[model samples]
Target chain A: MNDKLVTVLADVFGLRREQIVPQLTKDDVGNWDSLKQMDLVVSLEREFGVELEIADIITMTSVEKINRILKAKGVDLEA
Target chain B: MKLDGAVSLITGGSKGLGLAIAHRLRAEGARVIVADIDNVALEALPDVFDRRSLDVTQPDEAKSTVEAIAAMYGRIDVLVNNAGVIYSEPLVNLMNPDGMMHSYDRFRQCLRVNLDSVFIMTSAVVEQMVLRRTKGVVINISSISARGNEGQTAYSAAKAAVNAMTVTWSKELGRLGIRCNAVAPGFVDTPSTRAALNETIIKHIEGLTPLRRLGRAEEIAQAVVAAIANDFLNGTILDVNGGVTI
Candidate 1:
């Protein structure tokens, strides 16, 4: 599950893949402001090839929640 | 993006420059929706355009209008922020016995109509574009007065703000594949231009321009089409003023 998601988060937040975890949240990241939130949305949508609703985008505050939303959208995070 | 079959919403499209833009976009094979505050003018428009009565300064109304258009069309490819007023008043008027300074109320009204309307409409339209994953375009109608025109404090400020917002949005939204641009027209030969400035002032402006004439509404519309046609032309303030600055 951490393969592509970790890479995307790392690229967006300027962090390492090892630093990204399911429990990691916006509060834990220094650059996770509203602007970064948009960057994260763009990256996630492009990487997963899935269109996210506004509600889904707003609720994706943590890595775990992002995984859940992507899974619900039929994205195989594990693969 | 190509204009053919593109869904475009233009504010203040019932008359003047906005109407010209609407016609030009239609000629390019776009599905145009014209929104304006003038209900009578909107009703009088031909059946080719989907016309709506919209006061763009109202945030809630702007949001609902964008939502409705998106719902009906399935997607909105372009938004032209063109609803604005042309106002001219000196910052200070010593000759006037009633008041020496510009009215604060009038200043606020000008900002509400010109600046706030752009913010409201762009916010609503861009939200739908992002949610629907459509790589849209936002074209703002600015004025050469944005560089600072005499006796137009509020108008200049509002248009300058629009220019800044255009560039800022271009940088921020580029990642989402949304382009933001502005067309800053000089004194165009429109009714509003003639109304705002007398014939003498118009002639004076014409003499100042390198092209030795006032710009045409159709020329500004063509610049808008150029902005939309070029995919890499983001964050550009395309001055369509016929070398007035030169």
Candidate 2:
């Protein structure tokens, strides 16, 4: 699950694979602005096929938060 | 880029020009979805085309409709923004002292249904296409009234904006390989038109037009299909209005 997310962050944020650590927050990412955040949410939805709410989107500022939200939405990350 | 297997969504597809476009696309083997605000009209749709209840003017509804359609089909290849309403009244009523002026509500409703709906639906669908990295096509149904027809102040403004956006969208989305264009039809002979205009008005319009007759709904439909099929055509507003230059 972390591996897939790392790739998405790298692809969307124009970061290297190694830079996309699980602990990386929005403040740490160079290009993570409000617009990119919206783009990230859309990309995540398209990637995972889960309809995320606005609350979920706003709280998904870090990898852990994203995982927790996805988990709550019944996304089986382990698979 | 064949119509076969392509997923196309046409708004206002329950009747008039939208239904004709649906039929044209369906005949070519495209998987089509016709969405309208009217549930009764949707119920009347044939089994070949999918039907859904959609009020394109509402922002949330527009977004969800695109999402739901994309979920059902892996991708949406085409979107025809055909849902619109026309209010044929002067900005101010001067004929009768008792008559009220064009109320703010009516003007706002016209803009909402005719102009704002196109913006809302296009943004939602385009975002989906961008995320999926899909090269898609968008055809906006404009009108010859965009050239400033009398008694259509609100409708003309809305349609003129649509034509402008067609060019702007083509420029912005062309980088992503998505094409955008519009079709401007003039006085198409539809059931709604027949009921709305009397013989004198119809005859006057026909006399002014080069073709000397009102356009058929199918004629406009053919133009839409042709625009979609032609890959090189982009940002062009194909006018099918019998050369009635105003």
Candidate 3:
């Protein structure tokens, strides 16, 4: 599950899997604008088979926040 | 998406081309809501359509109306941005020497109706679609004038901008399962068209078109239906002109 999340983040941000750390954030990525954020939302939703609410989407500004939100939504990210 | 039982909204749909599109969508089994600023026209509409008064140029009005529709219908499956005026004015009027150039006030007015309204309404509707996780469709009514028409400076510019926005939104929203496309009609036989052009100019345009006739409003509506039905059709400016190019 962690590898899958990293793969989605890497694909959406156009970075390598090794670079997709939990500390990574919108400010850390040059291309992470509003549009890219939406792309990330779609990617995460598809990769995790989850429907994200607008509030969850807004708060998902970093990898750590995304992991927390997924866990709260009942996605078993720990696996 | 499937049209049956889908909630559809058509702005400026109380009459003319918009009304035609609304009728077609209803025939396809969609729940049709016709919104226009014309109260008289709204009242005159048949009992089949849900009527609402709307000024698409107002952002707050647009947002509230969209929210109301979503609350009532559960979700908005389709949005047809068919509200616009057919304005024509030359960049430079050789006959009117006193004020040879087109008025800036009129230019802004045209943009407000044709361009800004699209932005406002689409933003509101897409917000609902995104929030509800609805796979919605946005159909913008463009014009062949978008390719640039003579003596239609403001109209042409506004439509060109509409086309640009259509493409931009399609790219931005595709992943969310929302589709954006436009129907660019040629000279259609409608009250607005007749009001905008005299018989002589209309005749001249018909001669230029390969079909030697102005397009019917129903035919333009057919194009709108096609745009909605075809799921793969995205970011397209479907020109329903009778082989006329400008």
Check candidate 1 and list the clashing pairs. Answer: none
Q: Is candidate 1 or candidate 3 better by lDDT?
A: 3
Model 1, span A1-79: residue lDDT tens: 5588888999988787888988999878765655467788899999889999877877888999999999999998767
Worst 10 residues of 1 chain B by lDDT: B92-101
What's the lDDT for residue B99 in model 3?
70
Tens digits of lDDT, candidate 3, B106-147: 999999999999999999999999999999999999999999
Give lDDT for model 1: 0.91
- Whose lDDT is greatest here? 3
Residue B185 shift from truth in candidate 3, angstroms: 0.1
- DockQ, in order, for the candidates? 0.01, 0.01, 0.01
By DockQ thresholds, what CAPRI class is model 2?
incorrect
* Clashes by residue pair, model 3: none
lDDT of candidate 1 at residue B210, scale 0 to 100: 91
lDDT, candidate 3, A1-79, per-residue tens: 3988998888887788888889988778765645456688899888889999877877788899999999998999878
Error of 1 at B12 (Å): 0.2
In candidate 2 the C-alpha lDDT for residue A75 amounts to 79
Q: Give me the runs in candidate 1 sitting further than 4 Å from their true place.
A: A1-79
Please tell me which model should have the higher TM-score, number 1 or number 2. Answer: 1
